[model samples]
Target: MNHALQLPRLEKTIPLSVVPSRLAAANAAVARFLIQAGAVREGDIPQAWDDALQVCERALDAWVKRELGALHCFRPYFSLAAVDEAGGYPSASCKEPVRYHKVDICWGECREQQWAVGDALEALERQQAGCGAAVLDVLREKSRFVYPLFTPDLACDVVSYVYWCGEENEEVALDMECGDNEDEREAMREEMVTRKKLDESFPAWVIATPRKRRLSRRALARLAQDASDPLARDIAADVLALATLRIEDEFRPDVDGEYIGFGAVLSWREDDLTVRIYDDLLQMAHQSEFCDRMGELEIAIDAPQAMRGWQSAMRVRFKTIRLLDRLIDRLSAGN
Candidate 1:
């Protein structure tokens, strides 16, 4: 996969110091990056959000391109750091002709495409130097625009991303606000389509657990419903309570624009109990925002470690599959 891009001569030039928290570090770093970029006055910050944002918008122009690159999603992210050296950073700019240097700073994932990357790296750098307020700034913007309830800042591994959402300190709600019944249905259908594509790519497996290999006719109907798409999530949950196996998976299917949609493949595992868990999906867990394909499987949490191991294996397999597919496709196309 192509790596994320960078502009020449961009460097961070700030002295290291202790700060109260991540927020303070971010505030300070934004001040420094802005001052070097010749974007704002140092005194403008440590104030209300609006005044501080003016300084941010100016500097954001110089680095905004890095935020939109789609590659950051499929490939692992590396550091896009500011340069530092023994005893001192390259140069300090108390004035114009702002100093430049090179360094590496790793950033977290952002939906695998069109990352809202501006906040995390900024927060990280500033926190190391003693400020992370800009993290909050970017977060406020996200809460206003995207998933409102979930902070979307907390970084997690593939498994964690599916099980949980939100950042430090309590739950944040994602505002997938439903306007009316029609909108909700459409959203559900969209998610279902995404899940279907995911199953095609990763392909959910049905494991035979250590249970009686028999299920009710209702059980069969439920799996068929979840396996396809839920007509009602509530019913899905109720049916899930009867499941024995577990299903673990996620699909990064998304739309880039009005006419542009793309999908990121998924992989997951459930030990010795695929049929029981698959039965859960047949019911309705797919309807809720937090639960999908395997929501019912989780209710059988008398078995998390086995599920986790299976999920991990699945992730490895999916990643390998994606890489191999890309390589084969490239070789065939001779690109």
Candidate 2:
């Protein structure tokens, strides 16, 4: 048996019926599993416990990042101010902020459901093949069916995120989008984004089945051909297997129609052992923490002659507060 359970979501520790998702498909799968299992509990998939509110808030923050993606939709069309200029294309004065352009794309809300955990498990063990087929149906259509229903006129919402979907959806992205800059001016982007200045480089990424995205035969040959560090490259290939799950989470398609998705919990079927590639980023962010915090720190060496130290500290503090304030504003707008 190919282990009827699909995705790495079925860890060796989990039952064959348990299907976890780090993509939109999985969210639908989770929902369908609950329905079939008769474990439907009326609530959110991101079901936050009273004690877990803080953790939920942090996780939500990390997951709701693509709201500005709609802003890019505006780029194919208007200026930031023009969207709010009262009479710009799509009549920027409308109340909804996310504008719909390019008839090919749209977004919608993810529904709330009660997952009956016990029932789902029973169904999985007993229903067998039926359970697998049910989950797949939910995965492909539930969200896409509702995507075109939302109004796209949020002028102010341009900079905000849509929290309804998983971080799915694959359109080519600029390598220069280092996740820090918010300005969308074309002229300035050219000046600020040249080919990477740092030696570090991220590959051009896509969201898809791991089998398709895994280090390819051609990629292996290329890695072998390049001699700088063959062992390191081999190691990198292994590390990338885990990293690909994170990438899939980032680019998974919108099942709920919203730009950002209800984050997924994913796993994989590696030979001999089943594994998960990505988990919640907030909990695991420390894995990516820099080895050298000292590299960026500066020594006063000789104190600046023209600078009044307290005023400079105050200015730095002022900018920090503003940054946080903008962030909070962005979060509130989405919810």
Candidate 3:
């Protein structure tokens, strides 16, 4: 007699449940197993995960559109003055003095839930298969459903997809834009020049940022160990997996002296450590010890008091802050 609990495969044709997300489908399978085993009851999936998924879906929908595909919106840093002069300012609060964009991509949040889902899936799969248990044999076929989601390959794939999406969007935006008059045409030409410069600046900002000076493998190891929250520690590993980065500085030609933009470009690294997730940038970014040190470096890139002249150095500093902010925000959210 077969005693193992048989579970239903995810339905692939229903309108509401047909296209289950990778994380969601994996999580739902695990959640069902736990319920069957009396490990946990229904209504346990936190509302926060629901909220984060909603936001991620919206961003995905925006990027999927042909017209919007060329517009890079992931943690974008742009000069408010320049946008306003071009009649593209989305809001007044999105104005100057904010060097880094204050938007949330929900990456950390979604990732945390996915990791939790992965842990649950692994545990449940082990139990169901009777691995390390007294049972001699069982169906091993179901084990493959517990795929490793947190590996470097998956991480790099997702990040690359995001970058490609941005590039596609930017290309479409540039090609579709047209000027109505000579003055408008001149403005368009200048904007195009500025955009191109910003594009070139991304890679330099990633490699040359002052944050690279303070970062070390050993330091990340210690920070991960010392972090109070488990999620914070896991996020540390996520940031470390990022192999490359790019930042661009944005300025306002109309305002003459306004420095109001920055951007992020990222890819995966394939070194020895890339195969093994280890480094932690969030804890280091949040450390008070490095804050003043990085602050001093920031002054060198900026004009000491004013917010203009955000060179490559400044772009690096701001991106670090943005990553730190993202981690902190994710850690603070309800589970």
Candidate 4:
């Protein structure tokens, strides 16, 4: 007999029996918020809300399958549920129905619950009535479930490249200046040759330099063309493409002249891990400190800023590359 089967079974804190009602309540809250905010007309609230809910649910399902594939036993039971006063403590104001909840591992004995949804009613009631930040935050969080900034495979490739570059040439400094004049260019050719020597040894030396510099799309394109190794060239090309899409699609500046980005927190409890993704750029900047402890690679993108013409001030922190690689490896192994 398998000893694992003999062990006490872990039951879900929030059972699946209450999931439908919770989801309905949460969706209703979201619908009401949208209608009140004029995002959707009161007449079109039902269809619009249902469509949005379906989109979020589908994205959540895909994210769970991709990220938690190794935990096969928990995959089927994990679901998006709303937190009520009974199942879990509701938000501060109990006068209204709860508008906050997140994806729960419904089959396990996990106690920790993440805040995946925002309190729409509270935002309207307490804060500025027109402030739709909470609604946008919820949508952004769900969207990130489907579209992570860096996928596990891409992150691993980047880490490998950075490691290879660092290992190949420890003596070569990456502080060379580019010259605009022809004479200056000729003078720097020897330095360029030295840099090329470093690149020749390890072609994947595009990012993670000691000095901070914004990576312009033009620079990335140039690097892609100059890369000697096919793999390095492809990686540089991929980065350039991703950077372009990210700036164009996601990293738009808000009315406050600040760019918005998603932040994620990974917590491990025994063999199970939970990932909480939120739309808090300030928190992301605060979390950059983790890069020092947990090996990190920062990529600066020259994105557009409100009022400002253009700024290469966007920084993305990939601190969980190793952990993500382990998860990916376990998933690949059919665990």
Candidate 5:
């Protein structure tokens, strides 16, 4: 990855006492952007702001764990505005030099991570390229654009935005939206074809779609059973069994809700299958197998907040179906 495109590492530390105020400012800016874009009603700002704050808090917690520090501040370098284009609803666009810094107090220094609007646009393009232009183009038309100020890892990071495209919608709706019934069907057909191709190419690959309900054991079993390849099937079954046992033994029932995070991947060669579960898609690129297969899988969750639960459960529901593509290539060559 280009150094400019990669997320910045922490370099300095900010005072903990200033975090709450900084977060408030960041929330206010996001709320303003959403309202101006006509994405949110004035009456909804209060509740939306509260929800945004919660998401920031959750993300901050994750950052703390990874960086061993707390959030320092959010420095806004650019602002989001609604731009009216010919023959369309006002679209949100970022002004030039559009960027923001997410500062965290790590190792006694106030380190800052920057995500520019350009970076977001580039990331979106990469996502569309990976997942299929048709699928994302349809989603983009109907969905509100949300630019994450920080590096997003889990579903919560994506869902933290205050505004959604539709009125009173809680999450980023993945349901294919089209003008007519025929168009909808055509879109679905195209998506199904794309999915089928992905499956045939990478038997272990899985795509995580938005879900409305909790995941059940039966659903997981079905997923395991759905794998046509012996190795893929075995890996799926093993992941299911291990995830179930871990949840049962290490934690109580997930009263919060279902597991609806981003995605997971299981990579194996020959007799040995390795299970690696992750919510961050960008980090997957660091893996040797995924390095060359750019745009093969969606890199970010573009919808609403996903339900919180066992991270492993997400693996069962939306398994990584493409990680083995390169591995298979190498095996064929006896490399």
Candidate 6:
């Protein structure tokens, strides 16, 4: 991977402070970069502001060409990022620069040939035209020109391009919205294809859990409709009930974008009395969101342990599974 770009002469002129938050740090860095580039003025007259924007646009155009190569090789697309209603970067008003720093870059026919955020460089390298390599090289060489300052690894990646395709244009609105469950995903896919005439897309890195394995509302509906045996349906419903609490394996950060949190799966056999819990459901239990639901379940009585050994964790998981099964049985029979 290439190292981050630095314009040494500009850096020498201005000292940038490291901010506590990633976004703030990036904003400060970009503002400093733009000021140095003469694309933005600290305090200036109205006519100078327009002139500065013209300079900024020229910079974006040149950088895009140098980094991405021929304009025809890429497609213009917009990404939606969830913002906190509370506070942070002030939301863009109609008249101001969109200041959208977080976005996805995709090439080809808008849908088919796009790279996921982190994977973009690798995909570009694969093109063999050296566009990807060139882009990374230029980016590293003149890093400040890009928005939402990020490492070569794409960590803390920010959108630096100020221009956007407006919402009125159907052709440019490439949505990356992923619904929580497979049904929702399918529904979104259908909407994209039939209604929007676009292919359903997702982040390249996310490994989607299989539809059958996920215990979602759609899974519950499938079990209720397809399972011939009453007990099987009840057990599946109970599992879905537990999993739908949407327990997260990671802690909630103060600021986040669109996310579909993790869910759980139960692996059981027809003859076996115990079921194996997959994924970090115990971690879910520890989260306050699930505390009340977990407190009511007898399985919560067992002390939650950080899974050190699979053998030991499996033993504990079996007990918890059995407890859940018994609870389901009683509830089903009206006990």
Listed per model in order, the count of residue pairs whose N, CA or C atoms clash below 3 Å is: 32, 30, 7, 0, 17, 5
Determine the backbone clash count of candidate 2: 30
TM-score (all chains, Cα) for each model:
0.17, 0.17, 0.19, 0.24, 0.18, 0.17
lDDT of 2 by residue, 212-255 (tens): 22344344344435525444343333222322221111112323
Q: Of models 1 and 4, which has the larger TM-score?
A: 4
Return the TM-score for candidate 4, rounded to 2 decimals: 0.24
Angstrom error of the Cα, residue 280, model 6: value is: 30
Q: Roughly what TM-score does model 1 have, to 2 decimal places?
A: 0.17
Candidate 4, which ten residues in sequence have the lowest lDDT sum? Answer: 292-301
Assess candidate 5 and give its lDDT: 0.28
- Per-residue alpha-carbon lDDT of model 1 for 25-70, expressed as tens digits? 4344545544553334444443434322234543333332333332
Superposing every Cα of model 5 onto the true structure, what RMSD results? Answer: 21.2
Judging by lDDT, tell me the better candidate of 1 and 2. 1
Number of the top lDDT candidate: 4
Q: Between the candidate structures 1 and 3, which one is better when assessed by TM-score?
A: 3
lDDT of 4 by residue, 1-335 (tens): 65655667546443333334544566555434333333333333223233344434444445434434443111132233434434564433445544543222221112222221113222222332212222222222322422232221122233322323433332222323433555655555544323343333221312224212334557557656885555334444544443433322333222232222222222121121113112122345355431111111111111112202211211221112222223222222312
Question: How would you encode candidate 3's per-residue C-alpha lDDT over 1-335 as one tens digit per residue?
Answer: 87999897744432343223543443343333333333232333333344223333333333223212222122322111111123342332333331221111111111221111223222322433211111000101111111112222222323222222334223433344542455655565564423343334222212131312323445445444665657545544434432123333222122222111112111122222222221222232234332110011111111222322323234443344444334323422312
Which lDDT tens digits does candidate 5 get at residues 17-122?
A: 2324444455444444333333343333333233343344344334223322222222112111211222222212423221222211111112222211222222
For every candidate in turn, the CA RMSD to the true structure comes to 23.3, 28.9, 27.4, 20.6, 21.2, 25.9
lDDT of 4: 0.31
Prediction 3 TM-score vs. true: 0.19
